[model samples]
Target: MKKIIRGWVLVFIFYMSMGTVYGTNTEALMTEKAFINELLKVSKTGAVLLTGSDEILTREKAATLIVNYLGYEAIAKKQNNLFKDVTSSQGEISLVSQLGLMNGLGSGLFQPNGKVTVSQGSLIINRIKNKLETPITWKHAFYAIQSSSQKEWIKGYDAISFGWSQLERDANNNFIISTSNTENDFKVPVGFEGPIDLAKANGVETYLMVYFENKGMLAKSFLEDELQRASVINQLVSLSQGMTKDGVTRAFDGVTIDFEQFLSSDLKELYNIFIKELKSALQKEGKKLNVAVQPTLYFKGYDYKGIGEAADHIILMAHDYGAITLTEVERQAGITTTPLTPIKEVYDALYEAGLSISDKSKIALQFSFASLQWQSQNNQVINSRAYTPSYDKIEARLSLSGSMKHFDHYLQSTYATYEENGIQNIIWYEDINSIHSKIDLAKLMGITSVSYWRLGIIPEAFNPLR
Candidate 1:
């Protein structure tokens, strides 16, 4: 059964995003004990959250029941009372103490019943991550940054104007990054001219990101062994560092690695090592380094603290707050085609991420303005596609689809239904209102910089001076 905890996630995504841009096949690629620590941390607040499980764990005793699941031999061998106040069952306090993942404050008074502080929580997680097995093989140079067809440029607005209409003239001196291909293997194809032309024509920078996926994976295998992994990343960095020399790229300009939703927890150490090493190499060449990662997963013990500290800028891919369903199972479970980037969803996800990630100055929340098109039969969706309708296209569709203009105040996005020959078509899209939500979200989060997926989707009128 799908864990359809609909409406549980309010800060943005952290909502159940169950499908693709219309269930397009995409392969990809996270740890365990640290999760218990998170639950323990959350339990301290006494905030009872109801998921599917009926037990609301606000008490430490209930939280300690998970320690027996660790299956440690030392747990059974315990014959001594380590603390006077410890009351957890299954020898959890003993095992945690033996593992050196936790400690007492003073005089052998183990605060098993006490609330976990940030420092204590960090120590526990770091200890667990440090012991994770690592014997990974370096992936061979099997992938290349191959370009695909250029995005259809809308006339009159130009590429830059399509990004955000409120964008000042000075902001156009920066790069506008977007992905290409079938959403599986995001690579830099041959002669796809968006960032390059902008870089050459306006002296803006171009950051060509390259990645591959087998349904979210690191080259179809877990990439471990930091030394060998560094070699592979070094090659990619080596190519990227000198990749855009012909475009007259300026300082604080280089490749932005958009490899989010692909890395597993066991591979995070290697991933961090790769970024740290890559940043070092890029810095030596006076090139800037930026990495794109999801804020929700960053808290799952994936080592954002290391990556954020290493990269020049961290592009928080904060969009995709909700999801569009594709499969029969998802649709059957009350999955609706909703906003691509709901403002409240973003705020909630970011709020959770902000608990772990420091230094908001380095973050540039990547705002999205896209929607999904679904065609349903007998109240069930049969097929769907990611539809990014331009202003004129939206107008034509509205006239063709219907004029009700239904709005989801929670999502802060609009959707409409129309009957084309008695077939129901649902079009959920972004308008100027979506952009306003994004601008408000950025300010609320105390973030400064913002990046658009492509320079031509929305328009320049919405982008404010910054």
Candidate 2:
């Protein structure tokens, strides 16, 4: 049975190769424990179990095996304690409870003696590909596995083998894998290459030291970089969260407070402090300090007016016309009304606050590539539920026949609506269709510059920022 299964797998690979599906090189060496650890890191739910094998190798067992083999006995014990803490706190079982790669199997019960099936192996690899925060690189390659005659004749065996064989390729494509395997090995590989050469090649042994700076898991370095600027903005707003926009704007204008006191009462004070330190550090690194302030309409009637005096440019958040509440006309038109009023309001408030925001060229109007769904029953606000309109929901609502056609129409219609509504400044969320529409719209609107809500959320396709 096993021989027959292996034969079928071989045939499938042959067919795949002929079909030009087998392309990536799979010969990169990675340790089993590292591979498993990565898999757990990338799993969507933080839990991945070994499947495809006849024997059940739970996540717990896999983790235990990794800890024991890696000689992390003390760390393993700590992991067990962490697991207990997480389980007790969450009142649910989560893969994060276990510190090791295979979940929380513990020190003594990893069950390395059990056989792994093809399905189980695929699940593990897939989890790794999905969960790792770092990038991976994938190279296509043909894979073949030999099965013994005594093994069960399972169709899934070929599927599983093919699946595991693709892990290296997937990781490589994402720029995560330092190596891959073209041939089979019972052991795992280690030390895969990363996209960021400084960190990947710097011999930085610990993720904690390189990124978190000893704060450990309590601080998320990746998120910090991505959100630091936004955090500063949020902090500024939060400092006067309870005050009316007009009052806050006024306060910002005349308040004789230092930068520290400026951010003292905000929920995001730490972020503001971090930004100050970051600016100093960047200056030392020979980077210029360019700060841009984008004011929202919520500050129209607030205290601080001359807020843009300290920065390079003042961006006006010109969208969100339909944010607080939408009118019946907006609902029928399938778009927000003119955002000009709010934009002008914010501009006026900035001027009133005494910011030296010069000509219009220094101010850019921000637009939205996304839309909101107003949940209304019979045209009257039904419970005032609003949702971000997604492609799938828009298609379903329009009863479009196919995803491609629906997406095409949706993109065209959305862009037209924005243009027709006379929205000049725009910033798009990180989405392919939205980005494409913004490009086309920019050409139509004759706008020269655009910005993104974030750099991280932007897809790899737009990484070059053409």
Candidate 3:
């Protein structure tokens, strides 16, 4: 029912926008009236007085109308002059131009007094409407910097988290550093800092991701022990202060905690306290804190409200839905494929989190680039076993069996089934289209930040710069 209302609202908005630039006729005047009335009904802050449809709109007026319609009038009023030709509406001109809603005439001239054509007026109105619908203006990336093209994608993100550190505990339950997968001696590798420098130079914030990906995760115990948690927090704060690179000490803007242990709801308070203390510690060192959290759809341990208030950002790892949560009966009955990140599941997770976390801006939705494959024999899933296959391997499997990919509208994902010898392999993964669909949903929900799982596995054509 809510979706039906939303659809009608979109249709109404489109109808109203068409009246913004109507012909100078009695019918056009009626449409202009309807537009104004509809705009007033939808606008939270009262209606804006738009010029009559017959009146010629100047570029300055068009920009002002756009900024005002989007409720960015205050922000526009604060902008300084970007064009010498305009002064009275310079702020509006600058604001709209910066937002890509309008543009200058050329050669540092805004031509503020120039007439706005009907097409130009309609375009500006549509752009403003789009901005109001999806206000995403920032992006985040979880990077490994494994390939050269991976580094190239760095230009697209507002921030990047590199897995440069690992957290561990010794026999005494004391905090310690483990040898990083990317480098030995638990140090940032040489030449690896180049991406850091490049990211920083591009005005992109950098974060050191402190990971605990042990097969038998010791993180739960370490976090449960207050003393050990404090010790780890101190270590993380120190790392955030700076790392040695090329004879100079450079610091990341923040630290990201990626502890992969499943914390049950019983530990929710403890986990919230841990996050608060870690954030407080990092704050003392002038660094920010980011926590990667499993989606509440699967894990009820995370206190979204508490964590949202304490940390600068909380990345909801929204993938892996239905990956291993199959029932015994279903396993025996045989399954063709399981969705990795079902759209409805992701929606439910976000909606549940929104109930507790009032500030959605602090939330970053995660998208995975990996694929999960399951083996089937005799029309039954074998042991219900599933494993992640590389992109190349998935492609080769498809090529070998000549299996075509099918789009599952229900899941908003793509899947393929292939025969390997006598066994059937079913693969489910995100493609460019699926990722874009998720992104569209995220933006429609007013989410501004999105984080990729990692760099190398993402498609070559994927662009994060939107």
Candidate 4:
């Protein structure tokens, strides 16, 4: 009996040092030994064994987890320029940088102590998952990328998004050329910002969504006559043809219809025909077709089944819930602040659209990085037009230093409020933590893929996991 007890004690020590013990019967023993072990303990899932008081993850902690927990010692062995003020997390930060999973904030500063946001955290985890290259064997991955406003980026409303906008500034800080959202006809200028990069799309299939800026007028013209609709279809075919210009090809594997205009059921049929025709056209050229759909609750008149059958990938754009408070109709409903995209509501709507879990393998949950801003007086919000700043620009302008950051447990969003004058300002937007929460919800719903609405708003490293 004495010899057996001594052997168990030795096993506990080995387990503490090993950190990750996946052997049979050992898991139960590890749990019992955890009560005695003080240096380190194993995770309930047996996926990780973290040190005491290191429950919170940092860059260094992440590195250790990757090495010890995930057995990524080869990546963990590599190191970059270590900071003078940093005594820990160097290996993790270096491993992250070496794999292109994370980048420094300029000047070789890793800021290891800084907390990682949902976007950054999601990016890292996704990259790790990709690096592992584990076979899903069940769910298929669907990706969605959107081509949105050029002005939002050129005007600096979004810091990161401007990088993807393709609008460059001269040495004097002036736009090399001009772009406008007022054009009725769609045209990509010389080397104009297209959609997100498809080359680094990794393994999962992706769709490049082109924004029909003048969709309202196009819908109006199509409604007037069938010939006009045909003409519109011709123009769309021409836009897809534009992708092959200047001897460059394979920019996008598929073309996504990002029309958000108000379409009647009749127009929806016409649009369906348009999509079918577009899919046929792309098929002729050995390409694919995809689409960005509106949330079922907000946008009516869409034949979800018809569109779903026609498109190779369907992206459910379920953002803008928080915009209700700023809308003309919802302000009358006496609503205040809310999440930009509530989790359960989005999932319920998508699932009810008749797409089963298996069918959703090619379906994406589209997310937005913009925030809703409004002023409040006497605890009542002031009515305003659409006003949202990109996550980066807002972070640069107002930080959590003077403001209070609150997480909505029910909605899974991050909001910040600060006072510039006597008026109170409330802004709710997506962040790293909130993004992870949403992704968690998607994973729980058996979703295989998710998407960002636009490029450059979120870090390029923060690619969604398939």
Off by over 4 Å in 2: 1-285, 290-292, 300-316, 324-356, 359-369, 395-447, 455-466
User: What tens-digit string does per-residue lDDT give for candidate 4 at 153-180?
Assistant: 3222111111111122236543212122
Candidate 4 whole-model C-alpha lDDT, 0 to 1: 0.51
Candidate 3 residue lDDT tens string, 144-177 = 6464457878888888888767776566757775
Highest-TM-score candidate: 3
- Colliding residue pairs in candidate 4: 60-89, 117-432, 118-432, 118-433, 119-432, 160-456, 161-456
Best by lDDT: 3
C-alpha RMSD (angstroms) for model 4: 16.2
lDDT per model, in order? Answer: 0.48, 0.30, 0.70, 0.51
All candidates: CA RMSD in angstroms? 19.7, 29.1, 15.1, 16.2
TM-score of 4: 0.55
- Model 3 pairs whose backbones collide: none
Task: Kindly indicate the candidate among 2 and 4 with the higher TM-score.
Answer: 4
TM-score of 3: 0.66
